[model samples]
Every structure is written in structure tokens, then in C-alpha cells.
Target: MKTYDAIVIGAGPGGYPCAIRLAQLKQKVLCIEKENVGGVCLNWGCIPSKALISAAHLYEKSQAGAAMGIKVSGVELDANKMQDWKEGIVKKLTGGVGSLLKGNGADVVNGTATVVGPKRVDVTRADGSVEQFEATKAIVIATGSTTIEIPTFKFDGDTIIGAKEAVSLRRIPKRLMVIGGGVIGLELGMVYQAFGAELIVVEALPELLTGVDPDCTKIVERKILKRGGTIHKNAKALGYEKQKDGSVGVKILADGKEQTIVVDTVLVAVGMRPSSKGLGLEKVGVTVDQRGFVPTDKFCRTNVPSIYAIGDVSGPPLLAHKATKEGEIAAEVIAGHKAEKDWVAIPGAIFTDPEIATVGLTEAEAKAKGLEVSIGKFPFSVLGKAMAMNETEGFVKIVADKKTKQVLGVHIVGPEASTMISEASLSLEMAAFLEDLSLTIHPHPTLGESLMEAAAHAMGAAIHIANR
Candidate 1:
């Protein structure tokens, strides 16, 4: 049997990073993965989804290039070709991850590993080969998450499918019904909608992207409606019945009444659940929460001293970046370093049409905390860059404390909103006040200037908004 200083199970965004960090710390680390090295983010979720969205954006712009005397003739999208290209990108990225791991001198084992105890892991290889890994110091679990299935809606991987299958549809559905209006649902829905599908989304909440800023979500909902997508919220999808002709009949409760909607395809994007099963947690005396999330302290360390857990399996804000940071922290702690996991500003970005991003608390979250707050707004419609791009579909919003002027929240919806949220995140991290951001000398004629404008408005000194 082989022994190592640390052994990480599941080579994913969380696990792979932890493995490499430990190796860099001069530890003999063995990382085990049952599937591909890059896991779902590169293999399925983040990379492929973004590629499809990029294609959708290009297609959208090409369709409207004729407005300024720019002659556009024939433009059409081949779904199969796009899928092939997306697959190619995923392969390249996953391959890069494998190379990075090996370069760090981390042994990448190909098998399913189970924790026999705090110090042992049984690696079950393919072809019925099995071996055991005895960790001399620590073991980390970063197995990640999976999509939850609706009670009565079964996934057929063709007709009714999960986001995995939705990524790989050979042909676009004439009428697509996406259940749940969260990030995954809206993202994939937009891709198909941009490709000219009669898309309808049914969510259980009162509105789409419920936890996000309400006004901003309303703006996104309007944009989606303008793009010919239908939304049904506060609706409970009870079950589904397959028709004789191979169509799907979705039944839901809306406004205290039963309603049935038929569609060619159904995409379930309810939410993600932690993959805490079959890891032999019970054998190690490790306890999981009722929802299957591995409970951990602030350092990503579980109840056991020599064992740790991070990422989606550790719960909420199951983002790849969050997992990545937590993975780095856990590695440092395991390598006998003094480290603390504390991030005041964890940013959240949604890649919808008019992409939305927010850092720290929302307006409601701030109000709930009983803080006297003043909010500022800067619409992208007035920005030169936004208008020049012909993508003036969003705004920048800032929330600051009424007394200290310390920024508490930053929300944005527009082009490059995903990239812009990082500045807000850093400001919140530094506990930056309104003046700190507003007086930072933002360059002219740029989308980033909108952030400065929003901060200026929070100080009641915006030049863009007259009479502020």
C-alpha cells in the first residue's frame, strides 16, 4: 500500500486545487478521481455554458448588424457545430488541468476512493482493481454536488433532462419548458431562447432569481420577455405525464389552481445538492447535515482534526471561486501553516442577458440587519460605452451605510457585469467607504466609470444624474 502526507478525493475545482497546493507545500499528496480531472465545471457546467452563451451573444449581434446601414445577408446557426466546438474547448481545458496536476508532482489516481477512517482511503480502480491509501497526516473531501431531481419528473436524458443533457441537445426543441428560475435554468433557457426556441420557465418562487436584487431581476425578466420567453412563478410543478406521441405534459399548481402545459423538452434546474454519498463518511465517524452537507468550521475543517471538507459539499454559495478559495485555505491548514478562511465580500454573478452581479448584502438583506442605508443608482442607458455597444440594458447600484458611508452592497446588470463585480468585492473586502471608491479616479468613457458614478450618487454628488 502507498502512503502519502495528504490524500484528496474527487478531482474537481475544489479537490484538484487542494491537491496541487498541498504538493507545493512539499507534501506527498495523492489525488483520486473517478471521472475526468476537471470535474463538472470544466467538463459540463461553467465552461460549456459560457461558450454557448458567447455564441448566443455573437448570433444576437449579427442579427442586428443591419440597423446602421451595415448590410447583413444570410445568417444561421448550426446547433450541432456549436456543440462540437464547445466540446472541443472543454477537452482542451480538462487536458490543461491534468497537466497542471502532474506538473505539481501530485499523483492523479484513476478510481473511486472511500474513506475507511480518518487515516485511510480505499481506492477502487476500474476492472475490479483495488488499493488502499494511508494518509500520514490529513484527508480532504471535495466531492462537489449534483442536480436534485423533482419528485415526479424523471430524467430521460433526451426528452426530460438535467442541465447535463441540456448542454448537449443535438436539436433545439420547438417548445422548451425549463423548471426552476435559478441561475442554471435562466442561463440555459437564455441560450435556447437566443437560438429561437419558444421557451417557458416555471419557477416555484414569486419571481425569477429570487435571492438577487428585485428591481434588477425585474429588468432581467423584462429583457427575457422581450426575447420571447415566458415565465410562470409561484407555481408548483406537481408531476409530469408522458404523452403517447412522445411529448411531455407538465402539470403544476398556479394561483391555487391546477394547470397543465405541454412542451417538447423539460429542463430541471431546481438546485444543487452535495455529493456526500458513498464516501464512507459513516465509517470515519464524520457527521453530515440533514441536507447532506458536510459540516465544517470556518477553516473548512470538519469535526475530525485530521479530516476536512470544503466546496459544495460544505454548503451555500456553491460557486467554483468559493470552492477554489476554500480549497486553498484547507490546503494551507493541512500543510501545518497558520491560515484563516475569512472573505467579507464573496461575489455572485449571473450570466443572463444583461448579466447581473452583486457583492455583500442585498438591499433587503441590509434592511433586515436594521442599518440606516442610502442607495445610489447609475443606469447604463446614459453611459457612452453601453450605448456604443448597443447593449444598454442595465445599471450600477451601490448601497452604503447612512453614517459611516461604508459600502454595504454593490449590484450591477449590464455588459461585463461579471468582470466588474470583482472591484465591488474588493471594496467590500477592504471595508471601503463611499469616498474611497467614488474618488478613486475612474477613467473616462468606460463601463467601470459607472461604478464611480454609482458611488458618487450614494454621496448625493452624481454628475450624470442631474439635480442629484
Candidate 2:
């Protein structure tokens, strides 16, 4: 039997950071992984998807460069080469993770771990070897989630697939049907659409990207429509059939009517479910919820005091950054430091054509809570930078308290929205008032000036745009 101060399962965004931080805190930490070091986020989800999206954006821009007087012909997408490039990035990052863990003095074990007791874990390594380790202090479960595959639209690794396969497709389909209008679906769907695939989106909800700012979603929706994509709201993808000519016929129920849409591929991006099962958590008396989530307190501790859960396995808003933050907090707590999952908000960034980023309370959420709110909006179309970049498609919206002028939320939809959201997140974290944002001098002709201007508009003192 091996003993350690702490043991972390699943060497992912959450687990790796936790193990690294624990080792930094001078704890003897043992990190176990059943797969690659970076987990799904680094290996399959975020990094790979963004690489493909960036390539697609570049391809689209090259074709549209004629308007900018940068005319060139014969631009082609060698998908094999692009895929190779993406894989190179994944390999480098995952390699860095392994190096970081080892450099930080954390022992890395390649195996599948199961909780055998409150402080005991059994790791089944390759070659049918099982090793038992005891966590003298804590055992952390940082296993992430997996994509939910609809029973009817089973993944064939070809025509019908999930996000994992969607990002790795070398052959651009002539027509693609996405079964879900949420973040993953639209982001990847738009990538293929930019690469010349006609897109059809089937969303079960009344609107696309449910729970997001509708105004922001509207702009992306219009862009999809303009690109010759079809959106079927209040729809359900029943199943798919393989056609004789190697095409896929997808059956969908839309607006109480059944319809069949033939396409080359079907990408099911409904959502991801927590990876909480088959870990022997039940045997250790850990409570796995009906939805497969391991409920935890702010300290990331489950019902068992010595056991902790973080990241996608714990709850919703399954973001990699959030998981990393929680991992640090958990490490601090285990090190006898005062740390908890305390933050104003976790900002969300959607990597669409014109990205959408948001933080803090939304306008509808504030109104629903019976709060009187003031809204300020500034369109990117009027910004000089946007015009220069030829990416003027959306706007910045600020929601603030009507009585105190305190900024409640900030939403942006335009180029570099993802990069621009950190300021909004900082404002919320610091509880900045509207004047704090407006009075600050922003550089002239930048997309970020829209935030300052939006704040000014809320106070009816905007310079560039007429007061609302």
C-alpha cells in the first residue's frame, strides 16, 4: 500500500491544477489519470475546436479579401494538414501539462482510480495491475463530463457524430444538420458553414442558445440565416437513416409536423452529462445526484468531509476556467488556507463568427428578480475599429441598477468579444458603478471603447451616439 497526503483522480483541467497547487503548498500529492493529461477540454473540446474555428475563419476571410484589395486565388483547405496542425497544438499542450505536474513534485500515475473507502483509492493500472493508495488528508474527484449521445442519433463516427468527431472531420460535408442550437452545436456548425457547408439547425427550444442574452443571440441567428442556413425551432431530431448514396436522412419533428432532411452529416451537440458513475463513489458513501452530479459546498467538499468534487462532475456552467479556479481553491483549503469558491460571476464566452461574451446578471434575470434596471447599448457598426476590421455586426449592452447606477451585467457581441469580457468581469468583481467605467479614458477608436460608451449612454451622456 502506498500513502500520500492527497490524491487527485482524473488529470484534467481541474485535477492537474489541483495536484500542481497541492504540490506547491508542500503536500505530497498523487495525481492519477486514465487518459491524456489535459482531459477533454484540452484534448477534444476547447483547444481543438478553437483551432478548427480559427482555421475556418481564416479560410472565410481569405475568400472575402477581394473587397479589401488583397486579391489572391486558389486558396485551399488541406484538411489533413490542418488536422495535423491542430494535433500538434494538442500534443504540445498536453506535454506541457505532464511536465508541469512532474516539475511541481506531484507524482503522476497512469491508471483508473476508484474510491474504495473515505481515504482509500484503488488504481487499476494497465497490464492488470491494481495498486492501493491512501490519502492521509483528502481525495479529490475531478473527473469531467462526456457528450450526451441521443439514443436515436447514435454516433457512427462518420455521418452521425458528437462534438468529438465533429471537430476532427477532414472532409467538409456539402450539407450538415446540427441537432441542437446551443453553444457547441452553433459554434461547430458555423465553422463548417464558413467552410462551404449548407447548415440546418434543429433546436428543441423556442429560441437558439437558450439562457443566453436573446438580443445577442439574434445577431448570430441573422448571420446564420444570411449564410443560407436553415433554423428549425421547437424541433426534435427523431433519428437518422443512411441513404443509398452515402448521405444521411435526418428525421425531425418541427412545429408539430414531421419532416425529413437529407444531408451528408448529422452533428448532435445536445449537451454533456457529468462523469460520476462507476467510480465506486456509492461504496464510499458519496452522494451522486439524480443527474449524476456530486453536490458540493463552496469549499468543494462533498458530504464526506475528506472527499471533494470539482468541475463538471460537481455541477453546471461546466467551464474549464471555472474548474481551474475551483481546483486552486480546493488546494488552498486542503493546505489549511482560507479559500472558497467566491466570485461575482463566471464569464461565459461563445466562439461564434462574431463572438458573444457576458458576465454578471442579465437584463432579464435582473428584471425577473423585481429589480428596476437601466440598459445602455452601443453598436459596433459605429465603431471605427470595427469598420476598419470589417467585422461590424453586433453591439455592447450594459445592464445597471436604476437607483444606484451600479453595473449589474455587461454583454458584448462582436469581434474579440471573448478577449474584451475580462474587463467586464473585473468591473463586476470590484462592484464598479457606471461612472467608474464611463469616467475612465479609453483609447480612441478601439472596440473596447464601446464599453465605456455604453456606460455613458446609460447615464444619458454618450458622445458618439444620441442618448436614449
Candidate 3:
């Protein structure tokens, strides 16, 4: 039996970082992966999806360039080329992950791992060889999640699919129907929509983006509606049928009525389920929750002290960055350093048109906690930079405590909202008051100035906009 100080399963955004960090801490680390390095987030999910979104965004922008006095013509999308480019990126990043693990002195093994004991793991390699390794210090489970598939609308890897197939489609659907209106569904749906696909969104919930700030969601929702797209909220996608014309006919229930919509493709992006089962966790006395998540303490330790879990397998927000942070914390803890999963907030970024990014408590959440709050908002419609880019569509909103003027949350919906949110995250982490953001001198004519302006508006001292 081979022995190592620590063993990490699943070389994902969570596992790879944990392995690298553990090796850096001078621990004998062995990282095992059943699939390509970087896991779903790199190979199938975040990176690939973002590449498609960027291509779609550029395509849409080029079509609208006439309005910006650029008179450009022949803006055509080569789906094959875009897909090849996206694959190149995934290949480079996944290769980098493997190189990083080797560079950090962590042993990388390709196989499926099953924990036979609290400290023993049995790995089955490609040649049907089973190798048992003992982790003298800790065994970290970092297997991420898989896309949840609706029973009625099974993935055909063609017309009916999940996010994995959605991102790799070389043929743009003439008409696309998205089954869920959550982050994944909307983001990818908007991508195809930008590529001239008539979009139909079926959301079971009353609103799109249920947990996101409604005001921010409203802007993206409005854009979809304005672009000849249909939204069916409080709706469910029951099933789908393959039509004679090689299209898909989807059955949906909304407002107590059942209707069938025919389209070229159906994307069921309902959500993801944690990959926790079949890992022999139960045999080792490690508890797996009802939702298939591995429950971990602040130190990323499970009920069994020798076993730890992190990332999507551990639970939601199911974010890559959150998983990476937890991986580092777990590595530190296992390395004899005192570290815990402690943070003011985990920021969320949505890549829908006019992108939405948020950090900390929302206004309703604060008020629901019975705390009085103040709200400040600044629209991009009036911002010079937004006008210059011809992408003026959303706003920046600040939620603060009425008494203390301490910023509780920051929400942005506009151009580059994803990039602008890091500052808000920092403010929340530092417990910055409204003045901390408002008093800062932001450069003239930048999208980020909206944050400073929103903070100023919260104090009723805004310069560019009327204080509300």
C-alpha cells in the first residue's frame, strides 16, 4: 500500500487547489481524478460556457455596430471555429492544471477512487488495476456536481440536452427553449438568443433568478422580452417529443394550462446535484446528506475527523471560487495551520445580457431580518461610459443600514458587472461604511464610478444623480 500525508479526490477547481496547497505546505499529497483535470468547471461548465457567451456577445455587438457609427458588414458566426477556439482554451487550462500539480510536487493519478476506510482509498485505474493508498493525515473528498436531468426530458446529446451539451453545440438552434430560468439556464439561453435564436424560457418559479435581486433581474428579463423572446413563469416543462422535422416539441404546464412549443432544441438547465454517492463514504462512516452533499464543519472536516469534504460535493453556493477558497482553507487546516471556511460573503456573477453581479445581503434579506435599511440606485442610462459603449441598460444599487450607514449589500446590473463586483466584495469583507465607498475618488467616466455614485446616493449626496 502506498502512503501519503493527504489524498484529494477529484482534480476540480476545489481538489486541484487543495492538492497544490497541501504539496506547497510540504505535505506528501496524492491527487486522484476520474476525468480530465480541472473537472466540469473547466472542461464543461464555467470556462467553456463563458467562451460561448463571449463569442455570442461579440456577435451581437457587431450586429449593432451600425448604431455606433461603425458601418461594419458581414458579421457572421462560424460556429465550428468558435467551438474549436473554446476547446483550445479548455485544453490549455486543463493542461496547466496538470502541470501545476506536477510543479507543486503532488502525485497525480488517473482513476476512480473509493474510500475503503477512514484513511484508506482504493483507486481503480484504466487497466482494471486497483491500488490502495493510505492517507496518514487526511482524505479530502472534492468530487463536484453533475447537471440534474429531468426524467421526462432525457438528454439525447442533440435536440434535448443539459448544460454540458448546450455549450458545445456547433449548430445554433433557430428556436431554443430553456426549461429553467435559473443562473445556468438564463445565461446560456441569453447566449443563443444573442445568436438570433428565438428564445422561450419556462421557469417553475414566480420570477426569473429567484434569489437574485428582483430589480436587477427585471432589467435582464425586460431585455429578453424586448428581443422577441417569450417568458413563461410559474411554469414547468413536463416532457419533450422529437418532431418529424428533426425539431423538438416541448410540453409545458403554466397558469393551469398545458401547451406544446416546437423548437429546434430544448435545454434543461434546472440545476446540478452533488456527486457524493458511490464513493464508499457510508462504509467509512462518513455522512452524506439527503441532497447527496457531504456535510463538513468549518475546518472542512466531516463527522470522521480523518475525512474532509469541500466544494460542490460539500454544498451550495456551488461556485468555483467558493470551492477554491474552501480547498485552500482545508489544505491550511490539514497542514497544521488554523484556517476555517470564514468569509463575509461569497459573491455571485450572472452572465446574462447587461450582466448581474452581487455581494452581501440584499435589501429584502436585511429587512426580513427586521433591520431598517436604506437603498441607493444609479442607472447606467445616465452614465457617460455606458452611452459611449452604447450598452446602457442596467443600474447599480447599494443597500445599507439606515442607522449605521454600513453597506450591507451591493448589486450591479450593467456592462462588466462581473468585473465591477470585486470592489463590492472587498467593501463587504472589510465592513465598509457608505462613506468608505462614497468618499473614494473614482476615475472619471468609468463603469465603476457607478458604485461610488450609488454609495453617494445612499447618503443623499450624489453628484451625477438626484439623491433619493
Return the TM-score for each candidate structure. 0.98, 0.99, 0.99
Q: Tell me the deviation in Å of residue 441 in model 3.
A: 0.7
Report residue 221 deviation for candidate 2 (angstroms): 0.6
RMSD of each: 1.1, 0.8, 0.8
| lDDT preference between candidates 1 and 3, better one | 3
Clashing pairs in 3: none
Question: Per-residue CA lDDT of candidate 2, range 61-150, in tens?
Answer: 888877789997999989889999999999999999999999999999998899999999999999889999999999999999999998
Query: Least lDDT summed over 10 consecutive residues: which range in candidate 3?
Result: 63-72
lDDT of 3 by residue, 1-468 (tens): 999999999999999999999999999999999989999999999999999999988898878888768887888889999999999999999999999999999999999999999999999999999999999999999999999988898888988899999999999999999999999999999999999999999999999999999999999999999999999999988887788999988889999999999999999999999998889999889999899999999999999999999999998999999999999999999999999987999999999997999999899999999989989899999999999999999999999999999999999999999999999999999999999999999998899999999999999999999876
Candidate 2 has a TM-score of 0.99
| TM-score: the better of candidates 1 and 3 | 3
Q: Model-by-model lDDT, in order?
A: 0.90, 0.95, 0.95
Q: Per-residue error at 111 for model 1, in Å?
A: 1.2
